[model samples]
Target: MKPPDGPDFSARWAALRNIPPFLRMVWQASPALTLAMIALRLARAMVPVAMLWLAKLIIDEVVVLSQSGGPATLAGWWDSGLADTLLVLVALELALAVAQDLLGRAVSYTDALLQEKLVIDISIRLMDHAAGLDLASFEDASFQDRLDRARRQTMGRIPLLGQVMQQMQDVLTVASFAVGLILYNPWLVALLALALIPSLMGEMHFNARTYALNHARAADRRERDYLRMIAATAETAKEVKIFGLSPWLRDRYLTLARRFYEENRAIQRRQLTVMAALTALGTLAYYAAFLWIIARTLTGTLTIGDLTFLSGSFLRLRGLMEGLLSGFSRMAGEAMYLDDLFDFFTARPRIASPERPLPVPQPIRQGFRFEGVGFRYPGREAWAIRGMDLELGAGETVALVGENGAGKTTIVKLLARLYDPDEGRITLDGRDLRDYDLDQLRATVGVIFQDFVRYAVTAAENIAIGRIEERDDRPRIVTAAERALADQVIAKLPQGYDQMVGKRFARGLDLSGGEWQKLAIARAYMRDAQLLVLDEPTAALDARAEYEIFQRFRDLTQGRTALLISHRFSSVRMADRIIVLENGRVQDQGSHAELLSRPGRYRELFELQAQGYR
Candidate 1:
């Protein structure tokens, strides 16, 4: 479903509701820093009014001294003690100025620290929440967009913390100015509000429009970023160059970027036009109030100090009001983004361990059984695997063979419970797979898919990820590497197990596809799980290497249940049983020699590959 073009009016105000929770997050990030920021800002908020009042007093005193005709010379005035009050007042003003600067710096320092803490806190939360979601959630396009927005919010919404605090500070400052203005004339304060109200409304409307534009373009922005990455990244560089795709990618990025720029420019243009006119109205009101102040002074109805204070107060109040209004609107817009972050947190995994989950059984009894299982990927119409009955008996080595899109990988995912079957049930030792603790069940099964991640870390670290809890166990890492025959590949590297093995980082060594496959295979061994799955684990290796790897695999997994997926008939020929899948169902199951002896899809595929070898 398409997201709304933008939030509506009520939605904009409702977004404000997010601020309280957002502040709570900020407070949680660092309570001491949060409190320090508030205190510093509150202290700074009163500085402006105090300084202005002092200026008024100084001016009034100077006027009185000049009119009194005290002394002819500065020395004479000072000796007579007439200039004493002026001297003390000036010194006090200077002190206040210094305090203001120090407080401003303190607030700035505190804000910076608080913002960093909030970013880290929010980023960690986003990572943890994303990790807990079901694998299917990551596959959905809509979910991807939401995830993207939420990820952006980790850094993007951080400024809202400072903005909120500043808004509060501005509120206190505005209240102080308003009190002084009301003392002179309540109508002046009312007039200022009337003038600024239009400007505030204009700001709100435009900020809402800006937010809507960005929200609608989230998917486009993601695609643009992807294009940007593929055009320049090491992984895609070879393919991009070979295909001569630079122009296409550049044009696509430019198209999306241009649209974003144009939409932003349009909103900015309208905001400029409307806000400028409203701001001019506010200027007129300030001048009108200035005229009234001067008239009162001329009539002797107000003292010179009153005129000075009232005029300065009016000007400051106008600027403060404008800032408060605009800042509030911007904060509201930012609060809308908070919805994305909080909404992401609200997403709970559909596949979770049951309450009072049973511990996963050790030393398998009946092994795994899929009874009339049916499954489909999220947002997909056709089933990936349906009405399938399969089993991996204890101590049995089984292989799954199929054409492309024939659900070989789907079977592995279902066995690992990356996704739950939509129909029927999958059981382990007569108990439903869902009945066991999710983490424990996964820990019991080790799987290495064809597209395993080539991490930009030391070779040992890459293997250690399989059972991260045992990352520090050097002996285990080495043993796993030897079992997968990855030790031979690592031995050639200058730093052996410690060498970083990806082109993504500098001072890193890139490995060949087969070598990387060897490293990936080591991860499975590192797990030492009860049920092992190698899905196209040797795809990048030659026939000779593939045969050697499987030869060792069969020996290492002799008494453990293993499921293998491979297109190479040579690799599966040694398995105790081979299951052939067609569409989403098992078509046949037998020993390789038995299948080859029969006239079936399995035999046809075997002959086709064998002819290639011949």
Candidate 2:
């Protein structure tokens, strides 16, 4: 695959602008913890400069005491106390060391807590945003890449908060040390600034390159993650073992991973070389300043205390400058990654309810009518369904029959407003479906597709997802399950309603395909929707189960609208009417008996199916 293009310089700068908002989000995660962290950092920030100044004092005091003929023995020194200034300085240094250790621990503790809260906040927001997106967005590969990058930011960029806080603390310490150096000789400050300029620019350049590389490789990273999941997860374990796919999957993973490694290695190699050269230049400037300080002391132009303070400050200033510069680059890179997160959050769902949505007509009087509807999936040439006109009346049972990919499921999708028709409108009671409140619309139309998710939760909770607020209503759950014929299956479980239904969790009771299908069908009944749809959800059921379920489907869906999509003519024959679809257009429509007597696609298909029994 071709490598994706990297973000331009303008894009990188735009990403940087997201920092303030990102920091605001972090702070908002936990106000008290965030405040505590800031306060602790401020205190810790001044400690380094204070400790260095105190060291200078203690060194000078020792020299003065020795020259003044202080007590020789330890006991005499303690008793006479002539070395009191030295003793006091020594004690103060020890106290400063102890204070620094305590403040450091507090800052770390606060940071860890803040990180935890921020992760939770980001994860929740990510899930909520993803939930609001249109189904089409999830189907788009580019959107998936963006989502993958956004997901990584929740946990991967966590240390960014601490890094920024530390950078702030270091800035203050550098300023404090710089002031002391300036009082001695301002030229030294200038020399130190000049030395770090090269290194700072180098770091920024390399950081930008790294961000570009990561941005370009988003799709590749997503593929690698998918491959890894397929190789390791229980969901694919059966097929993987039967086909002996382990080696092939491993090799494919290695090929993709190695490509990423090679790209990253090239960037790292250049960064290493540039950083080394810059470090040598900084070291040269440091020693040059060191010699000048010694020359000033030798010529009687400076005292020992002044020399010690200036040299110590100069040494510290260089290290701090280097740290501050390097830290700024790392922070910029992290902020760039936040672009993905903020971008995902800011994405507007195209299928959202209108601002002034019309209330969904209760009892759905006129039912749903598709008027010359046409739809094409994104990036596709052929329409999934086109020029289709159909009506599903209230209290009617309609079966949509067709070959695979004959737009059977697409019609169901359009009815549920999962995807609006591209070329025409679908209206309910003479009002466009788009005018109805989206949530209310979905709630009124319950659909169970062939590929319905088999949740790994408890049996009761799984069915309860249909009407989540009524999950605690045991009577309602039991009623729905009984209607779907899943009650008998669940009643035999070791824990019954409380039993976990998938193999994902420990001690979970795995059910057969038919049993799982029955459980899924219950969710639709649980909804008690005005319009209930089953799109081949019972294909896994045995012949007897399928026949029995459809025989009672009308009573199960009494006084409501129903649309069933199935290839089994035996099941299709139970509907009040059957519509045959071919090549994204309806070919025929009638009762099963009427269709059997006609010379058309429906008659052809019905006869073909009947031949299997003969």
Candidate 3:
């Protein structure tokens, strides 16, 4: 069935229907706090009715005392004993006032705690879900839009949870007032309800329009966020300053923000006009009711206390009804926004493991074989790799040499199963790659891309991230660092392995590009996987350092399979065999001497680089 195209009342109602699940999530965050908040709200809800009634009693007592010739002076009034009833009523009011204040404080405190807990819970869930999605999903612009919206809702709509509780308390308070009015005259209840509907409808309509506008502008909002970050962040500061882009970026932000402001301003103006008209109608109704009550009081049918109580009740009822209706509309809008969060949560990962996954082969004896394999990234026309045929034997080292954009990294990704081939198949030990468990397959191959993350954490923690379970294993960390030739570099720091590595944090000591590469290479060593793919691991290292690292690489990877991608023919020649790639196809494959003996692309490219040095 086709989904609905635009915002509708039904979708808004459905958003309201998500309240139970949201509450359930809040409850799951902290049942004790949730219960405390509810209890406090309930207790606070009745205080208004009690306080109003007590005021009526005190007023009636004052009227009686005055008619019976009360004392003139303050001291006389205190001693006359005619004021005793009033004093007792005043005492009860003071006590109720204190209790109400305390309950309100308690309710707010509980909500604040619940809000933090809910934010943390929702944030964790978002991270976990994003981690499970396929690489393609992250690359798609539409999927990014959905993710951005959901992320904003996670932090932005936290107030919705507390608003729901407030609304509930308001409902109970309104009910108490409604019952009092109904006792005096049932028609008064109907009059108040009639007055509220028009404004309520207006609020609900504007809310839907607001959500629709925000929904359509999600991508623009993302762009605004990106531009803001780029204009002000440490990572982009150098480039932004060099290019003198501050004014341009600022203007761009203003343009987008102004468009949003204009659209929102239009809605707000319409909403205000409708609200004013409806509020005027409501005022007329209230005055008409007020005049009717006055006539009854003048006719000797109702006492002064009754007059005060009914008037107060009617006024309170009007405000409470207005709040309840408008709160409901605002909440519907909030819940509609929650559709983004729920929609993201509901999205199932296409790359999830099968229910009954085949076990990963032990030792991977036959190695990996790709036959007629092809894959194109999402939303791209050309294939990244096509009609590919390759084989990596167990314990053999292979080098993939190619110019930029020749599908070098794409092959590594395919081999690591970051993406499944769109055409043909990849098999490990004669079993299709998808047949094995997803996690196990990833665990079996360790890949370090050219652009690796430089984490702003302790040196030990940085390496530990490669195999997080071994974070506490100091010996394993040391061994991996030693293998990556990072131990001596780390030893030079004041805190050694405990030293923070990135410049982003306080007291952090930044490393040179070569040092950071060495640290990243340590992560692969930490993985200790059977199949290792290194994409230009020595790009930042000096020539001597590069040759030394490759020497260590050959020595360290004696019994394991490895694939090295580089433009440097010096490193490529060290491989047991070389495969030259061009335009997503393997143009040639052989040892360095055999390729050099032939008049082919590999020989021409090799000589081109060699001549540059002379």
Candidate 4:
């Protein structure tokens, strides 16, 4: 599956303006709630502006009262009627202040709730799409980067959108002040508009550069994070010390961090230089206005009270300029980041599962056949398995033996339908494999690969994951554990079947490598499939454990077609038929006694392993 090539950010940003579905969702989910929240925020903001204006009114009223014609005493200023006006303003101010606090908490809580909902929605959708994609798509580095960016941004998108509301309210405050200025002098209103330019440009330039660093260093960041985990994680600590790999992984992490720091330093330098220019522009305008305002008062055209009001309003206007400038740039950058998230959210898998899937009949009568099959890995020149002709009949036990890097696993993957064969076909009961439902085909084949997943879950849950839709039968889970000879391992644990099998969690018990391998085997046994494939499934088991597993393997595979791959001849010898694979083709195949009689690749491997036992 091909990933989207080279994101056109400009095109994507333009597309964000057409926020039909996303905005519609917010509206539909809680239109009244959203509007109520916005109204509360706007009401909260007006309180601050009113408080600032009321301050001036109080000062002006005091001046007028001081100049009144009637004979006045100190007692008059403290009179009940005069005190009541002051008290009402103070009371209103306190009420508005509490309203501000309440609104802050409410909006923060609502934003968090919405942001979580959005992340879950995006994560689930991405997981669904990721599931639909063929395994080959994960090979693309660009695809992984897209996934990472989408996930991170989705977590924070709503908070950023909420802040955009903050910027709008601030802008409205600036407009209200400017409209007041318009009554006094239209020239002051125009100057207020002109003041926002320098800061906006500076802010936009800095944020874009910061995001560029984040984009360029995505892989290195993840590597550094993994290195940290390995250094700190409990299970890895012992191995890390034994291998003397801590210093190496730490050095690798430091290298990535140093590179990130250098990029960050460069960005800081650029930001500081831009900010200096912006600061100089604001200083020039502010000083020139200060001198002009002083001259107006000295020449008797402007009263001290008028200057006081203008000065206070201009101070508010200046804060608004800074707020709007920074806020708008932040919003634009966040919107661009959101575009990346939205792009990924909307990424349809390159492979669309057919809406009407063809049926794969159960009981798998004759078994699967690989006919003239061939496969080459992605971005590779040579074939991993070329023209591989293989077959397995129902109720047959077939063993595949091969040297390292031989095509045995590749053939297994093809049979599992993890990858589509480049040429020719695999058939089930003489019907083309593609004609069968993908899920149904997988459900019919139970596979345990060489590198099986050691899920960090409870022992019961781990075994039950082999066939998750089976309702996690504890009795069946216990039976599978006994058949794989994992009973002793589970019994020693603190919580038995309920015990978590990874050191990542608190109170979780760790397992030996052999123990994990047995658990993996038991997990595979939970699947009631027509075919069972085990690839190097007991590499961690001791000689005795290996012998016992093969003794039980016959019982586990009774009446089912089974395929196994193993290096140990003690286990391989039990197979009814053995097939040895070389570089990309079959070298020799027969019963163990017959293959031993032939003195071929299989015989040489058997002797080599038997020598190791000595």
Candidate 5:
């Protein structure tokens, strides 16, 4: 799908609508910090005007002292107390300067702490929300693009917090300066506004264009990140070297990054050109105001003190107004990113449990049954499974034999409720699967697919992840490991069960394919699940090892319902009933011997394997 176009002028202003919600998240992160920051900023905001006003007072007092007849020497004036007022003014200005420094430090410290808290809070919310979403959402290309944008916002939008606070503080400072400016002549304030309005509009337009460019490039950025990962990561390093993929990966990354840079550069160039011209207009307006102040002083209509005050206020106000306008435009652009985060949170999972859910059956008496079930993955026209009917009788060991894409793994996924069927119903015992509490239903089943993760954690922790609540139950962990023959693998490690596995981290030892397979299988045994599904679980193991593992599996899971998927006919022959699947439907089913005696797909496949052995 084509990426959505960038926000227009109206949309940029509309993005400010996100500010309130974003502020609420900031407040939610830490109320004390938010309140502290605001209070400190308010105090700091008034400092500049107070300091400027004091400078005018000190100047006026010094002028009076210099012109009036008084003690000629410094000691004579100090002794006579004639310079007391000027000294007091100087002292007050000194205190204000010191106070400003202290307040500035306090604001920085508070802002730093608050930024960290906000980042942690937003990150946690993102992880929790993503966890509750449907698995299909992660698989969709557009959804992934949105997710990438939202994830970037977690860190990328943090500065918006300080930017917003700074903008607010600057507005208050500008208001104080404007009050003084208005007393002299309101037209000076009007002229400043007239000059800056164009600049503000220009800034807002360019910021919106920049946001639009980033929004459209989310996919390219994600691909670039992926390329960077594959080029150097531990998992891909070996293949990268052997396949000579470094140059190709580097070129692809540069290609994407260069396009992004060019697009961004174009927007920045236009902004620089337009904004520089507008800024020159503002500078001209400031000098015009200065000339008016000098003329008033020369005419004796304004005091020298008044001249100093008016000119200083005008300069500070101009800079503050410029900063306020530009900062606001940037904040609005950043606020646009908050839409990605809020939009992600707004996504609701379609496959969640009902409000009132039945408890999953303890013993799973009748096991699971799929009734004319049909399902297709998101963005695909071809159904992964269609009109599929199957049954797993309680306490029976069923073996499914099928080539890739014959719906073997899809059936396992359906049984686990990772997805609901697009068309028909699935049931546990006599009740609809959807009627059962989703979590409870999943807790009752244990599945170990062929491509299980090799976690970068201790051997024991890796196995414990299957049923994490029992992680501390050492005996159970050990027993499960021994049952899967992973105990032998762990025993060879430097720290035994505590040994960190996977080469992803330092001081970690990697395992062979067969050894990793054993560890993965151990996770299935860690669960106290009634129904166990093993999909090509022994593919990494040698023939003798596979036979030994399955022998132990059948012995350990004697009364539990089990479903096994494998291409090796030798393994399926041990199942009480073997199912042959073709084109997403069950083609044949019977005892291994029964199927082999007949001229069917099962017999044909067995003969092909047998011929390979011959």
Candidate 6:
């Protein structure tokens, strides 16, 4: 199906009115700075009004001086006073210009302070929520997109709010100009306001399109950005060079960036042309009024000074109106992006703490049972796993063997409670797994997948990441590394456990494939959990290393229930029980001796692998 059209601008504007008691919150947070900012803005505005009035006086007085017939004329009487008035006006203008500059500095510093506070507040709040979300939700793309955007862009809202503060000064400046022009023609003020209507409309139209573009391209933009990172980042550089794929990847990156730039620039060009045409029309009308006032003064319908004031104030009045109109639209557009950020900030987690959670009842002693379990992903035609039945007794190490698409990972995912079963009950001991606190349940299980991460940090940090809270426990970290046979790696390093493990940063060393697998095993061993899963965990290890590691793995999982997957039949032969699966259904399950003797699918698959190894 086609995706929905992009953002709704009208909806976002309404959100500002709903900003949770706006001024009160801002006032309570920084009242003194807020008031000081307003006062400076008001004082800056007065300088322009006083300048226009002085211009009108000088124009009329100079014209009269030019027309003087007698030696004692109005100009002669006021010659010395004119110099004083001009000096005072010049001084006022300079002082106001200086004050505005000071205010510009103050606003920048104030914005910096506000932005820092916002980032801190939001990061803290989001991190707190992140710890509460289910590990399964992290896999959901929609959830990830929200979390990513909020974390990256939410801090920009503060500067937008500061822009709104500046707009307040612009609005007041416009009002003062209108009041000063009243003596010439009251209707001229109304005309000036009317002329701004087209420009305001044009601005709103452009903002709508811009916001819509942002909303629509968020996913693609994220992809392009991530690809650029992969292309340029130090960690990916070695693999890219060794594989001789840098040229191909660079071309692909340029393709995506060009697409984004071309589309946005097209829209910008169209919008800019429309706004420019409207601005030219407004300029024409403003000058037409200036000429009309001059003609009226020439015909003796108005005083010369009145005409001068009317013309000077008219030009300032037009600028002030345009600034006000554009400022409002700018503020609204900025707020919409903030709303996108806010949406992520306030998202409802797929799994959250119960209103009144019962403490975790003891560790599983009986076993886990899946009765008529089923699950289908969003926008899928069929269930990934459906109506499956399985039982794993406590302390039993079972090996699940299957072909490529046989749903082995799906079952393991369910066992981890990353996604709830659609049509089944999953119970631990005798109670449902969902009834226990999510954190408690997850804390009891540990997993190492074929695609484990290689953290570009210290050797100790890489291992201790399995239990982040226990990272500072040096004894525990060392023990876990020793169990995974990674102590030899530490011994080879210049600084042992303190040595950096990846070359992304300074003073770091890269690892071989087999070595990285050992590090992953060390990470898994650090979890100290009852249920452990190793999915093709030794796929990268050499034959001898793989075999020896299995011997050590037996020691690491001595007291825990474990699940191991391997294409190598040697590992499967050692499991207490073997479950052969074919296309999402269990074909047979029994001890190695029993399954080998039975001449079933397990025996056939075992012989095929055994033939290859020979």
Question: Which pairs clash in the backbone of model 5?
Answer: none
Candidate 1 at residue 221, lDDT? 89
Per-residue lDDT tens digits of candidate 3, residues 1-614? Answer: 11113367777777888788889989988899899899899999999998998998988888888898867887998987778889999999999999998998888889899999999999998999999888888888999999999999889999998889999999999999888888889898899889889888878888888888889888999999999999998778989999999999999999998888888788878778888998887788888889888999999998788899889989888888888998999999999988899999987767756788898777879888989999899889999889999889888889999999889999988887778899999998888888889999999998888898999999998888889898999999999999999998899989999999888989789898899998888998999989988899789987678878877887899889988888888776888989999998899999999999989999999899889878
- Tens digit per residue, CA lDDT, model 4, 413-459: 87777888888899888987777778887888888887998888998
RMSD in angstroms, candidate 6? Answer: 4.7
Choose 5 or 6, whichever is better by lDDT.
Answer: 5
TM-score per prediction, in order, is 0.97, 0.96, 0.95, 0.88, 0.97, 0.83
**Model 3 pairs whose backbones collide:** none
Query: Which tens-of-lDDT digit does each residue in 173-254 have in candidate 6?
Result: 7778888776557878877888888998777767766766766667776777788888878768778888987787788888
lDDT of each: 0.91, 0.87, 0.88, 0.75, 0.90, 0.75
Instruction: Give the clash count for model 2.
Output: 0
Candidate 2 accuracy as lDDT: 0.87
Off by over 4 Å in 4: 1-36, 70-90, 154-159, 286-309, 346-352, 597-599
The candidate with the higher TM-score, 4 or 5, is 5
- For model 2, how does the per-residue alpha-carbon lDDT over 201-267 read when each residue is reduced to its tens digit? 7877777777777888889788888899999888899999999999999999999999888877887
Q: Looking at candidate 6, what is the lDDT of residue 162?
A: 67
List where candidate 5 sits over 4 angstroms from the true fold.
Answer: 1-5
Native-to-model Cα distance after best TM-score fit, residue 57 in candidate 5, in Å: 0.4
RMSD in angstroms between candidate 2 and the native structure over all alpha carbons: 2.0
Model 1: lDDT of residue 128? 87
